[model samples]
Target: MNPQHTRAFAKAAGRFSNTDRIDAVMLARFGALMTPQIRPIRSDIIRFANWSPPDER
Candidate 1:
């Protein structure tokens, strides 16, 4: 995993509630399991283009 992803996971893990600590653990586990396939964001323009205006059908 990249340092940015690892750091984000650490920050998220730190925010878990006491009763929901297991959910945080699960998030960490899933982050590791899924990180290998994660791709960098490509183009913001393409994303913006694909978004519809509020009045559009």
Candidate 2:
């Protein structure tokens, strides 16, 4: 998984320790609470949605 959002969450939490254990806990909390979207898969859905007719959409 990309660490981008995890890092962002850490920053948002005002964390600066950068320890592996702390990062792991932070990532777990981020995953559980935020449940960030999966990206490339979402792109495919967006493309289909955009191409669909207004009624279908």
Candidate 3:
């Protein structure tokens, strides 16, 4: 999450005080309002490939 956006949203909501409790509420509200889209996992991840050349085996 972007810190600038967080601060901006909190400030807009009249939550200038940056505290854990206040942040929790702000973030929860942000999530509810924004409903960010889910993305699939990257396909670049390593996978098992145990095969070797027949001659070498």
Candidate 4:
């Protein structure tokens, strides 16, 4: 889920303050209301696997 969108939604709902409590509520509500596409998080290992080492000079 997009944090910016969630925060913006919270702001639109008059939740001006940002706290863990507010974030939790906003995230839950956003997920429930928006039903955004879910995707897996890329790990650091996956990033390194996509890179190649430089050849010797």
Candidate 5:
């Protein structure tokens, strides 16, 4: 799904305010329900550096 459309849907669903915390929650919900494809990192170092649970991040 397009980011624009996702934002629009979130707005319609009463996410009127945009903030880092709120965006993270919204994206987490979206990812859980939508299960978007995750592209693998080309390098193990890069992946390891970036890897963390959402809560940890």
Candidate 6:
């Protein structure tokens, strides 16, 4: 998984109050119930190109 996805999964997991086993079960159930979304996959070059510099473009 990508860093963004990992972050998102962590954020989702953080929202729940449960033990690791329960969280794993919840994640599995959530994954099973949700339809997958297809997001655009950017290469490192594309990602960098899209990033604006702190001072200027």
Q: What TM-scores do the predictions have?
A: 0.30, 0.54, 0.57, 0.62, 0.50, 0.36
Question: How accurate locally is residue 31 in candidate 1, as Cα lDDT from 0 to 100?
Answer: 77
lDDT at 41 for candidate 1? Answer: 70
Tens-place lDDT digits, model 4, residues 6-44: 878888988857588877877888889999998886898
Tens digits of per-residue lDDT, candidate 3, 1-57, equal 566777788899998675899899998887788775656655554233544466863
| Candidate with better lDDT, 1 vs 3 | 3
Q: Write the per-residue lDDT of candidate 5 for residues 1-57, one digit (tens) a residue.
A: 468756876787698457988887777777777787777666977989889878864
Q: Relative to the true structure, how large is the alpha-carbon lDDT of every model?
A: 0.64, 0.79, 0.75, 0.82, 0.75, 0.61
Candidate 6 lDDT tens digits, 1-57? 243554466567664544787656656655665535657766987888899868764
- In candidate 5, where is summed lDDT lowest over 10 consecutive residues? 1-10
Q: Best by lDDT, which number? A: 4
User: Can you give the lDDT of residue 15 in candidate 4?
Assistant: 80
Where does the lowest 10-residue lDDT sum fall in candidate 1?
15-24
TM-score of 1: 0.30
Please write out the lDDT profile of model 1 over residues 1-57, one tens digit for every residue.
565664566567674344467655756785766656756777997798799878765
Off by over 4 Å in 5: 39-57
- Residue pairs with colliding backbones in model 4 are none
User: What is the number of backbone collisions in each predicted candidate, taken in the order shown?
Assistant: 0, 0, 0, 0, 0, 0
**Model 1, C-alpha of 22: deviation from truth (Å):** 16
